[model samples]
Target: MKRFVLLVLLVALGGGGYYAYRQQHSAGQEARASAVAQPRAVPVEVANVELMTVAEEVEALGTLAADEMVVIAPEIAGRVIELGFKEGESVKKGQELVKLDTAILSAELKQAQADLGLARDTHERLRSLVSRGSGTQVSLDEAIAKLASSEARVELAKAKLAQSTIVAPFNGVVGLRSVGVGDFVAVGKPLITLTNIDPIKIDFRVPEIFLSRLKVGQPVSMRVDAVPDRTFTGQTYAIDPVVDINGRAIRLRAAIPNADLTLKPGLFARLAITVDQRLNAIVIPEMAVVPDGMGKMVYVVDGGKAKRIPVELGKRLPGKVEVLSGLTPKMQIITAGQMRLRDGSAIAIKDKPLRTSQL
Candidate 1:
């Protein structure tokens, strides 16, 4: 049919007279035919599917906490007499942190001691008189009762005097002082904050599905914005026995040693808990995979054509990803120039096919 058209045109134009026109027309038609017969091949690169060993990890939002935290408060109201510890100072357990005025307590203690001394003398005299038949039994019994009461008062007075001093309940770092000398503080008013941060606690939660894998000493690694570029590690110390009904999560606590005193309480934490690891797992370069709207997809060059394969992805590593399904070892994948390519589109590889290791 093409030959007939060319011959008819030659006859009308006269071969020699239209030689230049014939050449141009013939070239244009040839180009059009070539385009129709063969579409442009999209250039791409491919890699060999590989096997990788990777840890199956779960991530959770968490918080750092002081191992022990308490607000030091006074049990009885009094005028603050003296400060025993400096702000942000490390204090030993039972160290005095604050002291309240003791004038009233001191006077009461001395009076009680004097009364107790008198009671002892009277009781001794009464016993001697009774044994010698110089004292009535009723009189001796009354004196004995008075001595017991006086002794009880002395003990009570000592307890009140001790309350005038506030001692550290545990070894910790004392926070800011809330009251100063001469400040009248009420009972139960906070005097300062004390925290035991050595071997700090971390609290986080994970889905209930991981309950079976959780243990008392499972390892945990974490990062925090406050301590940038550093990873803190610890072992799981506690797990809530009951799962949260609303969220279906189990609360977990880990203890990380703060030997350097670097970690601070209440810092936000990102934790990665390694539940398990998989060996001999198929993996590929993360860039080879593309989004498929419904799930994920990757293109493989098979018989010089792009085959769009829907893939299921697994755990990921830096610059590489795990292909859980829909691919095989040594399958040529189109790593580049995939935007213009579709199913069965011809592909021209730009680089030599390399192994996933090269990724």
Candidate 2:
């Protein structure tokens, strides 16, 4: 009977321990379920919606061109006696640039002048005799005709003499000369090149769709591979009235001040034309934007939870973007830790909120 009592007590103790263990296990599972139901907040970085100045810009490729360029050539062929200009040097308008041998031209001019003088004397003598009724009217008429012809010859000779000397047509820089002193050149042969580049012009083409936005006097900025460290600024001066049929583009020209003469013609240029600008525009960092199926979305912190909001995008800046719609100022936008976020997911800010001015 004593042994039976001991066995029963031991069984009862084991049963109590098992019942307690079951209760504890059930409670632990319930705690785990509760924890899952209420997840911890996701940490993120946030910034306020920015209200700043923004510009609408269009980009294009172009080539630099001189304001005025011309090939310096002679109108009359002759032996080049003297060159009045040095290559790669600046010259003034009407300055002597080249002189051709004018020995034959000068002699012809002098003979023509002597003939004009003789004809003038004969015409005068015949006029006097006709007035006094001593010379026939026909003779006077012949003398008058001869005098006119002689005068015309003299004028032609003078013109030919002037053509032997070439003068600069405009203020510009002279390029390399193809012919030098003592070199015989033919008529219309290119002697050198003259370029006027103080106020340089750049020609670029833009798509026809941008025609309405483009106009004269719009500000433009440009960069070139040759001048990497500097950015040149100018304004649109001309737009082609007719669209290019082959390329469906409109040609544009801008004038840039190049007093220092740093920008050279034929250099490849990258152009940015500012068509529109706004002083008060809503902006946000680019990283805050998320791509949805066909649209874009961003997360905004509202009441310690992330609320995904769709946005209409505008022109993009360096690392920021303009918000055209669906967002207002002072909204906190998540810039980081967006991968784990869903609509209405709880968020814990990891740092101080950045203001628009700070951006």
Candidate 3:
């Protein structure tokens, strides 16, 4: 009875061991086959980078300057007696600006008038005497000379009196006053400054390459740093005939209308001039390009691989760039995931298409 029980237990143990070993072997084979059948996940993306040819544009930065600026100065020296206008006041041409003390000039004018009256009487007497042969020719001639000299002195005194007052030469805005009442100023000293704001001039510079594009009356759009939202329109008034040899640039002057006096001289501004226009050109997002040390290039995707292609770049606009060469409209390019890729790298396509806004 004991031997029978031991034999049954042995049989059961052997059967259990065989069953466990077969199960383990089957699982191993199944795992190997599954590993071979399943595809590896290669985190990747797809981009349809197209080739394009775009227009060429040039950009430049410049400053704004006055079209006409001048300083007010006294031609004759005298004490300032009256200020005709306040500082920063707008004055018209020939408007009175300053008045000088003319007390000495007034007295001199009075003395000349008395002298002229006496000379006139003497001249009349001499003429009558000469006609009657009672006066010598030499005496009549002396009297005539004295009368002419006295009249000249009277005119000279009146001219001096007129010089005592200063007037504006043109219509402009007056600047600060350098002198006040009772201040003595010398000749050629600056009394004030004035600037013509109407039809203001804006001066800027452009590269010499745009020399041919610049015309005498080309329109220009300008914006001031102080007033970004406001854009002033003007036309090119003049171009410097000579180019700056040191900077390789051409100076440009444009006339801007500042009727409201909003634009002031010496205020910095940004200027833009459109050289040319294009009807249709190849344009791409800026991210599609990868700049190399020597040149620029982009990765073209084909047959689940990345192919590096070099390209010639042209004008770069906001968010879009112009491709001069090495691309076509139908070609696909890798815009995203470029950093993780290299030349001839295997790639997998993503489900979603790339959008222009994505870049």
Q: Which candidate tops TM-score?
A: 2
Return the TM-score for each candidate structure. 0.64, 0.73, 0.59
Which RMSD does model 2 reach against the true structure?
7.4
* lDDT per residue (tens digit) for residues 1-359 in model 2: 99999999999999999999999999999999998999988888999999999988899999999999999899988999999989999999999999999999999999999999999999999999999999999999999999999999999999989999999999989999999889999999999999999889999999999988998999999999998999999999999899999999999999999988899999999999998888889999999999999999999999999999999999888899999999989799999888789999998897775444433
lDDT of 3 at 218: 74
lDDT, candidate 1, 145-184, per-residue tens: 9999999999998998898899988989999987899999
**lDDT per model, in order?**
0.88, 0.93, 0.81
Candidate 3 lDDT over 1-359, as tens digits, reads 99999999999999999999999999999999997786442335545544444434345566666666788887778899899898988899999999998999999999999999999999899889999989888888899899999999999999989989988878889999889899999988998987888988877889998898888877677888888889888888789999999999999888889898898888888877766665456666788788888999988776777888899977887886777688887777676767667787777767676454532
Higher-ranked by lDDT: 1 or 3? 1
Clashing pairs in 2: none
In candidate 3, which residue ranges exceed 4 Å CA deviation?
1-58, 275-359
Q: TM-score of the candidate numbered 3? A: 0.59
Ranking by TM-score: 2, 1, 3
Q: 1 or 2, which is superior by lDDT?
A: 2
RMSD of 1: 10.4
Identify the candidate with maximal lDDT. 2
Model 3 clash pairs are 49-333, 51-328, 53-282
